[model samples]
Target: MSAVGANTSPAIGQVHVLADSEKELPVPKRQRLGIAVVSELDSLKASSATKRDRKRQSRKQKQLEKLPEPCSSDDVLWKDIVSVLGGEAIDAAIEDGKDVQAPLVLQEEVELEVKILGSNGDGIAVPVDSKQPWAVVVPLTLPGERVRARIYRHARLHSFGDLVEVVEPSSSLRDMSRVQCKYFGSCGGCQYQMLSYESQLEFKREVVVKAYQNYCTAILEENMPEILATAPSPLQYGYRTKLTPHFDGPSKSVRKGSRKPTTEQPDWLQIGFNRIGTRKVLDIEECPIATSVINAQIAPMRESIIQNSHTYNKGVSLLLRDSLDTSVDESVDRLSDAFNKHICVTEPKSTVREKIGEWVFEYNAGSFFQNNNSVLPPLTDYVRNAIFPPSSTAPSTLTHLVDTYCGAGLFAIVLSPHFEKVAGIELSQDSIRYATHNAKLNHISEDKISFRAGNAGEIFAVVQDFPRDNTAVLIDPPRKGCDEFFIKQLLEFGPKTVVYVSCNVHTQARDVARIVEEGRYRLESVKGFDLFPQTAHVESVAVLRRVD
Candidate 1:
């Protein structure tokens, strides 16, 4: 059936509210109480550009040009905020045959064929008939899948919905099997478990390439390196070494910000993970993505929580870390058995051992380490080999290596053998402490590898000591990626080689664009690692060399 001709209705930009009884899925109380203010959009005007738009653009550019150079993007944190500013939605009791004027009215069900997947892994379907500008985004539906969905939200650009069911599955679903975990759809932990392992790798690669082409196409026009083939994961499932399951007490009628404790008992302890898009928690039994040892602790952990659920009047987050593998070595296994038991029983305060390749790393259980231990060796080796290319006929001219945002010193410690001296800088003292211990654990000399708790604002302050022409800087920033200040500082420091690692490719592409735009660095190569299998997340590493 053609989706366009079925029950044709007038375009509406208003928000719609559904009664609690009409909601198919149990929405969190917070979402049910949300006030949506949608803007009225003229479909024809929106589709076609106007002369006033050019004038407005010219005015905006003039204003921006007047702004001071080196403006404080450091203080500015980029975020996308959508707000609804008008009236309540259509009545909850609207007749079934009656035409609704609300575009994203709750309980408004539609059958859509998904055309593509959005960055957050949602299936986007633009209506073939609608003169309206917005598309319907349905979660848990793949590209080319015909799905039934109920609209719940109206953002500026698109409408969001929850998938009711797949009416007709995509061809890709032929390769996909049933999701292993029972809580796969509800839990936000994994997004692509339904997709086959090989397909997941390809999807991740497409995500990286699309992000760059969409956000940083101008930079690519200058010098776009072919994004290399995605490195496959050694283990698809049972790869994660850590899991943080949390619990929050049942909702209360107490006044907000009141310090007084409520005498009324909670209905039940809501534990496990936050529901896919809501603050509501779904009690979890097992996570297939986590290591077998970590999954084994779920029963005992739940038992403990049940026993103390009454005491937990507030929210609590429990950390489970399978830091050590017993199958690594005989002697080390015996020594780490006590440590592993201690980690499982109590909160890890001291260092925990994690076996990666030949080295046993000592890092705090809570510290930042590679999430997927199975793919960490290959990821690290790729970075190490990229630093010194075999194709280069000249010997290594790089004397010093500086690693910024060196959490637990993974890159610094592993790549120490390639450089004369490596200086690792971190903002967190706790991470630096573990990093130092990890270096010692790996038998790296103190003189050769040094960890420092340095200021992020002054990240390149230490690079002054090393010759810019002979130094290489490695940065593996958090998911938000580096700000303009850091990128500006990096450009000023002007190292010989820069290896940028990031989990979020959009931000990585943005930062890399600035580096190449400055005409100092040329993009050498880009490679993605499937560190997070069964999910949309991909770890990407980009290599850039100083233009001679």
Candidate 2:
């Protein structure tokens, strides 16, 4: 009993340890002392972390600072991304806790991505997920390129964006050449200068088709006819017959803190179009699209205005109209009238007569001639064919013709021979005066060709008393389309045939719908002419026959 008690007591002098993976190794005496020091310092400043922790957080902040700022909260990037990949895919991707950056890149890398479809001066349209449901319209983009973009604005249900990169270049881009003018992209005067002429035609055709389809709910029976059918420009460069230039007083901010005399200073002036996407003036000395004659005269015109600034405090605007006959005497007379009377010289020089069917008409350069001189014969022929088909069985009744919105009696004087008498109604006194002169020049009896100055909408009141049998009306309204009053008047007059000519299809379609619904006019034939090549603008002629 004494031995056993001694052994048990002896065990207290030695330590026995059991192995445990969860337990940490014991620290040395020096390490323990250092930990004790750290704990004491942390307790002294109990609210803040240690210096090591602060250093780690600083490193993280620096890393974040290197990344780009996120787009505005209202941006459409997220919406577009979600749209491209269905909502289920988007939700699943987020739940997977994968890197957010991966989704953006994945969305952009789609095999067949939506692209910018087309552009006018205002904006561009991009195909979204739907074939035609939604379009992403970005300003300043050429069509047919797949682009990675950053959407920064949202409108109604669509979105707007800035092009980041062209993921795939368009065939049109490959053929595109450097713009003829340096200021083309910024001047807002020309939108398709960068595209090849062929590409420009395609672009314009698409614009017409889309506009008619989207805005009018009318189906374009065929893709827009070939660009050649629209009439290519004979002289692509220096073709503009009219030019207007503006001047603003000197920019005082630029002259600040200068000792130069204000009288000798040059004031800021603008002679071209407003800046792209803005009304602010961009000073232009010469315009590439204007004729050389016009450009050559601009400098002197500007100088004259500058010299007379004190005498004429009012700002100045310049207009130069082209005449078909380039006789110096004629040009001088036209210019003198424009300068002295502030009248727009419609005819620059007297040109030979334009013959349509049996009718003939003369025009001056200052007067309005369809800018596409090459296409007018064909276009007018088309109109004539549409109105009076060639057949031996045609009705013998005297076909009376009324030309509303007639300028210089283009349609009226040209088609007068086919009718017993043709009447032309115009708003501009100058135009009416020229129309009268035009009739005299062509040797048409004044009684046969009557020119009246009045509003197109009120024209029916002036011509209502005339016979209506075998009667047809030809109207080429302004880009704003005909007014409701005019449409209503047309309905009441109820001519057998109505030929509606328009430069803007959207407004034209609206008017056409009204005429068809209320006037009982059936759309028989509609055709578009590409008068302004290298631009989205197109001229459309629609024939509507009264429904019996």
- Number of the predicted model whose TM-score against the real structure is largest: 1
- State the TM-score for model 2: 0.64
TM-score for candidate 1: 0.76
Q: Give the TM-scores of the predictions, in the order they appear.
A: 0.76, 0.64
Residue 462 displacement in candidate 2 (angstroms): 2.4
Worst 10 residues of 2 by lDDT: 67-76
lDDT of 1 by residue, 428-478 (tens): 898888889888877889989998878768887865788888999998998
Please give the CA lDDT of all the candidate structures: 0.71, 0.59
The 10-residue segment of model 1 with minimum total lDDT is 74-83
**Model 2 backbone overlap count:** 8
In candidate 1, the residue pairs with backbone N, CA or C atoms under 3 Å apart (3 or more residues apart, or in different chains) clash, namely: 16-89, 37-84, 37-85, 37-86
After superposition, the stretches of candidate 1 with alpha carbons farther than 4 Å from their true spots are: 1-104, 174-178, 253-267, 325-350
Best lDDT among the predictions, by candidate number: 1
